[model samples]
Target chain A: MVLEVRDINTSYGDVQILRDLSLKVEAGEVLCMLGRNGAGKTTALKAIMGLVRPRSGSISLDGVELTAMPAHKVPKQGIAYVPQGRRLFSELSVAENIEIGLMARGKGRDTRDRVLNLFPVLNERMKQRSGTLSGGEQQMLAMARALCLEPKVLLLDEPTEGLMPSMIAAIRDSVTELRAQGVAIILVEQRVDAVLPVADRVAFIENGRTRDTVDVETLHGDLSLVHKYVGVGH
Target chain B: MDFGPYLFLAVLEGTVTAAVLALTALGLSLVFGVMRIVNVAHGEFFMLGAVLAWWFSSMVSGSPAIGFLVAIVMAPLVVGAIAVLCERTVLKRINYDPEATIVATIGILYIIQQLALTFYGADARPVQAPVNFRVVFPWFGYSGYKLVVIAASAVLLLATWFVLTRTRFGLIMRATQFDSETAQAFAIPVDRVYAVVFAIGAMLAATAAVLIVPIQQAHYLMGGDPLLLSFIVVIIGGLGSIFGTVVAAIIIGISDGVISVFFTPTLAKILATLLVALVLVLRPQGLFGKTPR
Candidate 1:
């Protein structure tokens, strides 16, 4: 496994978010985490990224313990996260946003050129401020920024939350491309149909606990499987 | 003197004030812009710089120029180190909460001021100008050193601008300022950034103090006016806008100088305060600050 979270418990103050949640992903695999809102889907990803401290749990990447590492150091260890709301630096130019990500890993123009190739639209708007971009374009920039890290594992939190169908397709294609490149992905998404094509396995979470871990083939054979856990159907 | 010479003198004096105010207020703005915390002890940093300049210069027995040079180099470094210590020890402990930081910095202000009073005493002390010469203008004569002050301040301001816009460290700072959490996710050490920015802010204030010490005496109580004026400059310039701060400083400084020469110093202050009130009522975000999205 490239990344593993074993029976981790995470909380914010007195309110617990994740309880005994465990999951694993191998290289070249897309693990889709599905659950109702507040089912600790986001928290699980955060725990792995060290954004939220896990009260008691062991998180490791390639057998390297990451439970005690600081949040900033997580990216340096080859994990990149594309958070919800596409938090781009509003005042900065698109190029500058990409530059910041490159600065983190001590990479330069070569990496920036490569990342921009994945999102060609960003190349044109290099001098434009990110906040002024269209919603879809902003999402592209956020992903592009994360891609600058050249991460081994990518954690995406709701990449298609507010995007249109075309933008959604673009994002799905990018995820598929990343998975094909042998990058491990832990995706927290709500749309089952949108996730089905890209995901290899489904880890259904309910109330902060892993309810079931099933292959996409099993999930595809029975539509009721998603409905039973996520409480929603396409 | 006639109105022409009188106005010329006022403008010269105003330019000097604006130059110094820009450096001091820019420091405060940087701290606020990145950290999102108001440092009430900023003026104390300026006072500390002047006090340290006096101490350093006094230690040297040679030419006043040698002493001034030593103070210029050492004062800001010492002040920056102290600011780093404060950020790590006090501000970091509080997690830089906006309200709490204000109170903490206010406490810091008193502590720094009291310490200055205890060590340096209550009497105001002056440092000699490094180069004693007068510029003989057609209408009147002016201190050549004051002109040097203007040139030096401009150079410093330009250097600061270059650092903010041209360097890799600048990119990290801007990113951290934009969204610290996102910056962290990309492996930017935000805590270290905060400490460095805080130190840079204090160092700027100290540098400004050292420059002005030859003209204005270093006194325990001298921090009050610079503090008030810089606050006005920062507010009117738009809280975190560096360019706006410089522009606003020039406007306020010139007006204060002109009004003081023509009318009274008290009136100049009243006018400046009223202008701030006007700015607050008309445009709360500041002249150059962008409206919240």
Candidate 2:
């Protein structure tokens, strides 16, 4: 397995956010987690990324345990999280923004050149500050910055939450290309259509727990679980 | 009342005073800029610097030039070492609670003051200006060391400017000032940076004392006036804008020189305080400060 999260439970300020949410992904495979607005989607990602502390369960990437490390160290350990907000350093230029990812590795020009090539828009606006970028452009910048780290597993929380259909299509293409590079991805997304076509398998989450997991093709037809867990009658 | 000579004297005095104020304000501004700590005890650090410089000068066996160099060298290093100790031992425990830091630094201030009284006695220590440089160019016979002091201070200020604007160290320091978490995320080692920055600030204050001791007799309590003035300059300049501090310090320096010469020294202080109050009330964000994001 590339990454495994088992029986993970977490809370924030006395309010529980995750309960026994378990998911597994093989190397280079695309895994989609489906849920409504507050069904522990972001929390699970935060817990896995070490941004939020969990009260119970173990999270291991491949064979190495990764439950207690600080969020800043997580990227160095080969997991890069493009947080829900895509928190790029707003004051920094795009090139400087990407360079921050490789700061720990000591040199970034080569990685930067490569990431820029992946996202052509970033190449053209390398000197422009991150603040000036549009929503889609900012998302691309966040992803490009993380890619500079050359992370083994990329955890993206709602990468297409606020983007045009064209941009969403572009992101799908980018992820597909990333998969071809043998990079494993765990995509948390709201739109079924946006993620379902690309995902090999899907996990439907609700009320801070994993309600069901099935192949994406099977999940598309299994409208009964969707009605019960997602409150959507399909 | 011969206006021509008196006015030129005041201008020369103002130039000299501005240099001292510039150095003092830079240290205070640097601490507040990066740490977000007011460092209320900073003034006390200046007081300590003056006292140490005097003591070290007396200990050195040489001409007044060697004594002057000794003061300049020892004051900063001593004060900086003390600063590092305070940060590691006391401040590390407080975690930079503004109220807590303010209270804690105040405690340090009084403790240092009492110790200074015991160590150096209540009497003032005089630092002698070198004989060769003491050839005063008579500006209405008000003394020409003011002009020499002014020139020397200008060089230091320019050097500081060059280092800050031109160095990679300044880039990382400025980055930390802008956002602590982001800088640390990039592995800048924030804890070490904070200590180094604090040491640099203490060194600047120590340098200010070295400059001023020759002009004004060193006293244990002399730090109070500059400390108060730095607070006003800080308000006028806003936090972290070094350029703003320099501009504001010069304005205050001129106003202060004129007011002290024409009016009483006490009245001059009152007027400066009043002006600062007016500015603070009118624009709390300070003259060059950005609104909190």
Candidate 3:
């Protein structure tokens, strides 16, 4: 296993969020975590990335223990998180925002060219403050910033939330391309159809615990299982 | 009454005051910019700088020029090191909590003040200016050192602006200031950044103090006026704004210079306080400060 999390329990100040959550992913695999709102999907990723402390568990990346590590150090250990809400430094210019990631990891200035290649629009608006960009543009900047870390594991929280349909398709294509490059990804997404093609397996989470893990092909043939877990109207 | 010459003198004096105040208040603004903490002890750092300058200048033999240069270089470094130590030992312990850090800094202020009084004695001491030349104006002669002070402060302020806008260090500081949480996620050690910022802020205040010590007597209690003026400047300039701090310092510094020359110094202070109240009530975000999102 490239990344393994076992028996992880986490809480936010007495409000328990995840209980005995266990998951695994191999290199080049895209693990899509599907759940309704408040189903602990974000919390699971947060715990794995060391943004929030897990009470009891083991999080290992390529056999190295990552539990209890500081969030700042997590990226250096090969994990990059594109947090919810994009969280781009609004006042900073686009180039500066991407530089934050590279500076943190001590990567050379040339690495920016590679990340900017992934999102060409960002390259054009390198001098513009990120807050002025449209939602789609800002999202692209966020992804580019994370990719600057050159992480082995990418944790994306709601990358498609509130995006237009066209933007969602663009993000899906980026995710598929990244997965093919052998970067392990744990994507927290609500849009099932947008994620299905890219996801090798989907973990259905309900009320802070994983209900089951199903292969994408098997679940695609029987849409009712997804409906049962995620609700009707798909 | 021939008031024209007096008016020119007042403006010159105000410009001098404004120059010094800009350096001091810029330090305060930068601290607030990165740490979001109101350093009540910032004035004490200024006091320490002046006090150290006096000590360093007095110790050296021969011309005052060598002593002044030595003090100028030594004071800010010593003060900056002291401040970094304080950040590590005290401020860091409080987790940089807004209210808690304020209280912590206030405590530091008293500790430093009392220590100065204990060791430096109660008498105010003046350091001799390295250059004792005068530039004769139309009505009167002005100390060339005062003019040098004004020019030096301007150059230093410009250098500060360059560092903040054009350098990689400034880039990291701005990124940390914009959103520390996001910066941290990218692997910036925010705690260390905070420590460095705290030191730089203190060092700026120290630089201002070292520059001004030749003109004014260094007293343990002299910090009160600079402290009050700096707060006024930071508040009026909008917290954490470098450009705004400089602009506001000039306005207040010149006004105070002119007002004190014509009227009582008490009234000048009153006007400054009134301006603070007005800015807070009308444009709380300050002239250049962005509205909180």
Candidate 4:
């Protein structure tokens, strides 16, 4: 397992959000997590990123424990997260946004050119403030910013939410490209059908627990398992 | 006597006030900008710097130049260290909560003030100017040291602008300022950055104090005016806006200098307060501050 989350319990204040939640992902595989709003999908991703501290659990990447690490230190451990809503630094320019990832690791500008090649739009809008970008452009910039980290695993939360169909296809294509290069991906997506095509395995999370895990090959023939865990026709 | 020289003098004096005020208030704006906590004790840091400068200069039994130079370097470092300590011990413990940090900083202000009162004594001490020269104008002579203060402040402010806009460090500070949680997700240590910013903010005020100590006597209670003026400037310029703070400082400083010379100092202060009130009523975001999104 490239990433393994074992029996994690997390809470916000007195309210528990995740109870004994566990999941796993392998290198170069896409694990798409599907669930309704308020399901523990985002929470699980946050826990792995160490944004929310899990009270008791063991999160490891390639046998290295990451549960006790700080949120800022997680990316250095080879995991990058593209949070929901494209949280770009609005005041900063697009170049600065991408530069921040490289700056964090104290690396030079080698990866910047490569990432810019991946998203030429970001390069075109390099000097523009990120807030001025369109929603689709911002989403692309967010993914490009995370890719600057050159992580072994990428955690994307609703990468296609509120985007147009063409933008959604753009994101899906980017996911496929990254997957081909052997980066493990934990995609927390709401559009089940859109991600199903690229997903290697689909994990259905309901009420803070994993309901079922079905291979996309198995899911392609019949989505009965997905329907059972997700909804009547999801 | 010709009125032109007097007017020139007033402008010159105001220029000095604005220079120092810019340095002092930049600290306040920076602390407010990144931490979102109004450092109530900010003025105390200014007071502490002047006090330290006085102490360090007095301790050196040498040329006034050497002693003053040592004080200039030592004072800000000491104050910056104290600020870092304060952030780690007090503000960090409170999680930099907007409300809680205010009260915490107020407590810090009192503690620092009282400590100075006890050790530094109640007497206001003056440090001798390191350089003694006058820029002889056609009508009147101006102290060269004052010109040095003004020039130094301009350079420092420019340096600050350069750091904020041009450097990678500035990029990180801005990223952290924009969204600390997201910055952290990108592997930027937000807490460490906050501590450094707090120290730099305090250091700027301390640097201002060290520069001004020769002109004004160092007293435990002298922090009031700088604090008040800085707050006025920050509010008028817009909270956390560095360029705005500098611009506001000049306006307030020159007005304070001119009005105080022509009219009364009290009127100048009253007018500044009125300006702040007007800005607040008309444009609450401040002249240079971005509207909260």
Candidate 5:
């Protein structure tokens, strides 16, 4: 396994948001997490990134304990997270935004060229401030910013949530390309229909617990899992 | 009183006062821009600079002009180092609450002021201007030292502008101020940056203190006016408004200079405070502050 999470429980001050949430990802595999609104999907991702601390249980990437580290330290340990809302440094230029990501991984020119090649739209608007970019462009820029880190495991929170159909397809293709590069991915998506083609495995979570988790082909065959667990129209 | 020469003198006073206020406010603005804390102890740091310049000049046994420069350059560095220690050891922890941080810094201000009084007494120390320096442009009846102040302030401001716009470290500072967590996510080491910014702010304040010592006698209480004026400049100018302070300083300088000429210095002080208050009411962001995004 490339990443292992076991019985992780977390709370925000008083109220518990995550309860014994456990998920695993093998090398070169796509793991899609499906859930309704407020279903602890983003919380789970944040817990892995060390943005929120887990009160109990263990999370390890490449067998190194990651649950106790700070949010800034996560990327340095080979895990890059494209947080919910695509938190790009809006005031900075497109190039500067990308360069800031490199502060985490300063390997060389290959990182810059690789990120630009993946999100070619950003190459033209390198000097423009990131706040002016269209929503699709911002998402591309956000992902590209994370790509500069050369992360072994990419954690994406709702990558296509607010994007158009064309942008959605573009993101879908990018994930497939990344999958082929032996990079493990954990995608938290609201649209369950799209992930059947891209993900090798699927886990359905509701009310802070995982109920139905299955292989992608198996999940697609079982429409009742979509209706009962995913809460898609019955 | 000859009208032409007096008018020229007034213009020169406005220029000199603006330079003084603007340079001092630069460091205050820098600290606020990066750390979002109003360092009330800044004026005392300026006094330290003036004292250092005098000490250094007396040590050299040559031109007092050389001593002033030493004070401007070295005093800030010393203040900056002290600030680094002060920030890391003290201010970093209390930053979670804005009101608490301001109050804590006020306590620091008292401590610093008392230390000055203990070591250097309450009596005013007289330091002479350079031997070559005197009221020049006697044709216009204006002081040459005031013009020099204007020139020095302009050069410093320009240098600061260039560094902020054209450097990566500057970008990091901006990011840290605007959104510290994001800055750290980019691996900027936000703690180290904060310490450095405090140091830089101290340095700027010290330089202003040293430069003004020749015109006004240095006393333990000397920090209060600049401290209060700087606060007014920053507040009326808006927090973190670097360019706004420069423009407002000139406006305030001229207004105060004119008021003092017409009436008295006490009346002039009230008018200066009123000017800042009126600006705050009409345009809360001051002359140069951008609309918050």
Candidate 6:
């Protein structure tokens, strides 16, 4: 396994969020987290990224302890997070945003060029302010910024929210491409049908606990699992 | 005797005031923009700069010019270091919460002011201008050092702009300013960035204080006016915009100079205060500040 998160419990003040959540993803694997709203899926990602410290349990990447590391240092350790709502530096130019990501890893223009190739739409708007980009373009730029890290593990929080089917397909294709290159991905997605094409496994979370971890084929055979955990039919 | 010479003189004086005010207000703006904290003690940093300049210049026995040069370089560095200390010890400890920072900085303001009073005394001491010359206008003569102050301020402003817009560190600062959380996710050490930014802001204020100390005497309470004026400029310019801060400084500075020449200094301050009230009522975001989406 490339990344292992074991029995992590996290809370915001008195209100507990994630309780005993556990999952693992190997290199070249895509682990999709399925849950209803407020099921602690995003909190799980934040715990891994060290944005929100887990109250207990272990997070290890390649057998290196990460639970105690600060949030800023997590990116340097080859874990990149594209947060919910596509938190691009809205006032900054597209080029500057990419530069910030590249700067994190001390990567050069070569890495920038490669990342830009993944989202060619960004190249034309290099000098344009990111806030002016359309919703789809903003999502692409957010992904591009994270990709600049060339991270071993990529955590995407709802990458396809409010996008057209075409843009959704584009995102799935990028995930597929990253998986092909042996990058471990933890995708927090709401739609079961949208995740099946790229996800190798699905971990259902409910009220801060991992309800089940099943293979894509297993979930396919048991569509009711999605209805049970997500409270929606595919 | 006529309106021509009076107008020219007022404009000249206004330009000098604007130059110094821009540097001071830019410092305030940067701290607010990045850290989202209102530094009530910012003026104390200015006061400390002026007092330190006096101390440094007094230590040297050579040409007044040499002493002035030493004061200019040493004062800002010393003030910048103090600011870093403050950020790490007080501001960082408080987590830079807007309300807490305001109260903490107010406490810092009194501490620094009292320290200066105890050490530097209550006297308003003057430093000699590095260059003692006058620019003779057809209508009247003006201080050559004042012109130098204006030119030097321009260079510093340009340098600051270059650092904010062109350099990689500048990119990190802008990124942090826009969204510090995301900047952290990208591996930008935001706490360190806050420390550096606080230092830079203090350095800018100190530089302004050093430049003005030769023209205006260095007094323990001199920080009060600059601090108040900087708040007016920052508010009118919108909170975090460097360009707005500079532009607002010019407007307030020039208006204060011209109005004081025509009428009274007290009236000039009243007018500027009224202008701020107007800006706040109508364009709360500032002239150049983008409206929140």
Evaluate all candidate structures by whole-model CA lDDT and list the values in order: 0.92, 0.80, 0.90, 0.91, 0.80, 0.93
DockQ of each: 0.83, 0.29, 0.76, 0.87, 0.43, 0.88
- Clash list (residue pairs), candidate 3: none
Cα RMSD to the true fold for all candidates: 1.4, 3.7, 1.7, 1.4, 2.9, 0.9
Q: What is the TM-score of chain A alone in each candidate?
A: 0.97, 0.94, 0.96, 0.96, 0.97, 0.98
Leading candidate by DockQ: 6
lDDT of 2 by residue, B52-152 (tens): 87888888888987888888888989999999988888876898777899999899889888899998889898887653444444543444555666777
Model 3 lDDT per residue over A89-203, tens place: 8998898888887876788767788888889988789899999999999999999999988878999999988899888888888998998889999999877886788999899
Backbone clashes in model 5, listed as residue pairs? B76-B203
Q: Per-residue CA lDDT of candidate 4, range B11-81, in tens?
A: 99999999999999999999899888899899999999999999999999989999899999999999999
Q: What is the DockQ score, from 0 to 1, of model 6?
A: 0.88
Clashes of 4: 0
User: DockQ rank, highest first?
Assistant: 6, 4, 1, 3, 5, 2
Tens digit of per-residue lDDT, candidate 6, span A1-234: 479999999999999999889999999999999999999999999899888899899999999899999889999989999999999999999999999989999999889999999999998999999999999999999999999999999999999999999999999999999999999999999889888899999999999999999999987667888999998655
lDDT of 2 at A213: 85
**Model 5 misses residue A207 by how many Å?**
4.7
Q: Give the runs in model 2 whose Cα sits over 4 Å from its true position.
A: A1-27, A30-74, A120-129, A186-194, A197-218, A221-234, B1-5, B130-138, B141-166
Q: Give one digit per residue, the lDDT tens place, for model 5 in B42-92.
A: 887887777666666666666677766666677778777877777877888
Q: Residue by residue across B41-100, what tens digits does model 1's lDDT show?
A: 999999999999999999999899999999999999999999999999999999999999
True contacts kept of each: 0.86, 0.12, 0.81, 0.98, 0.21, 0.83
Between 1 and 6, whose TM-score is larger?
Answer: 6
* DockQ score for model 5: 0.43
CAPRI band for model 5: acceptable
